[model samples]
Target: MRTMSITNARALIIMPAWNEEIAVPDTIREVMKYAPDCDLLVVDDGSTDSTRAVAMQAGARVLSLPFNLGVGGAMRAGFRYADRLGYRAAIQVDSDGQHDPRDIAKVLDGLDAADICIGARFAERGSYKVTGPRKWAMQFLAFVISRLAKVRLTDVTSGFRAANQRAIRQYLDHYPAEYLGDTVDSLVVAIRSGCRVTQVPVEMRVRQGGVPSNNPFKSGIYLARSGLALLLALTRKRSVLTKLEG
Candidate 1:
């Protein structure tokens, strides 16, 4: 495990919101309730809705993107902000409210001994209200990632995760922007770069809105594309290793 400097131990909570006007405020409020000391940042990914206004009103610093960037882009923006502000740790929480904000503490707790901490909803003790196909896809991706990355991850695509400064620097340097299916790409990069990753149980709720961005068909295509990408990533040698060693 990489040893992080204790002097720079501030934690920043980042929410990458696209069109979560209704749930963003509540998510921010819940996160603040649990992790009161952490600073909150909401990266509005060119939302047509009032996501920026709602997030700002809910007491979060908003990073408004001029155009719609995918999840990876929004998260890269958040990581850049955290790096610029010199924050020691960053926790990513989705604004759709599918992930419980109260579980932020659990992620942080897991981060104490690891470079990155992931919140695994399936490993937790709670009911997950998701479509059958999506659930099965998650399980399938978990198995694939375990084989390719050599890490036993229960929730390979979970957005609810925490990363320390080492991870923040590494991701800001080499985050893949296009065809970012899920959080798996970032996790794979971190793990390959010699970061210690740990998973904790987290309760997940159904989206407050009845609709989800991913339908069964779209999700299936995403899974296929991401699976291929992961295989390619695994076959390639570690670029991060060369940089770190050099």
Candidate 2:
């Protein structure tokens, strides 16, 4: 595995939020509670609610967008911010609070051996379970991406992930805004760019608030769209990070 020392690296927790007024505050608070030293930035992805104000009130730096961009766009903005401010590492946390705040440090620690570390739900660490097409689709993507990345990755679509400086630069250059692009295609891009990837088993929790987005109907669509996204990522031109600035 690629090695790096994050012993003194400045880390940023990037929470991409859209219309998560109810959950964002508690999530931010929990992050502060667990990882108090890390800087927290909430990217309000054109939230139609008071996400921006509430996040700021909850003691996080808020980056507001004019319109709703999906998680991909919000994350792109977050990475750019991290790059500008010289954060050595960044971890993506859901504002809806499914990701456990206590695991933030574990995910960041993954940067010690890999450019990107994913907090995997199905890595035999948690009781997280998925049924039907979603489960099948996740398995297929994990298998394909593991081959491409040359690593045993059990959860390629996991949003709870961390990136070191190298991976952050790669993300800034190629992070996509398409459906499933943030998770699946983005990882493929990083792998193609010569970034090392790995995963840490993490438990998935029920959302503290907001309606769950996944359903039986959406699972079928996710299966199809995720496959297409992976195909496009594989066929897309490779962006080799020859000499990136830290």
Give the candidate number with the greatest lDDT: 2
- Model 1, which residues run further than 4 Å from truth? 1-9, 129-133, 148-151, 235-246
lDDT of candidate 2 over 1-246, digit per residue (tens): 222245425899999999999999999999998887689999999988889999999999999999998999999999999999999899999998999998888888888888999999998787999899999999999999999988899999999999988888889889999999899999998998899998998989999888987899999998999899999998766666766454
User: What TM-score do all the candidates reach, one by one?
Assistant: 0.86, 0.95
Question: Candidate 1's residue-wise lDDT over 1-246, tens digit each?
Answer: 232335325788888888889888888888788777688899999999899998999988999999998888998999999989988789888888878877776787777777788898778578765565666767777887676556678888788889887788878776666665337776776677777787898998878753766778887776677677676556544435322220
Candidate 2 lDDT: 0.90
Give the candidate number with the greatest TM-score. Answer: 2
lDDT of 2 at 71: 96
> Which residue segments of model 2 deviate by more than 4 Å?
1-5, 243-246
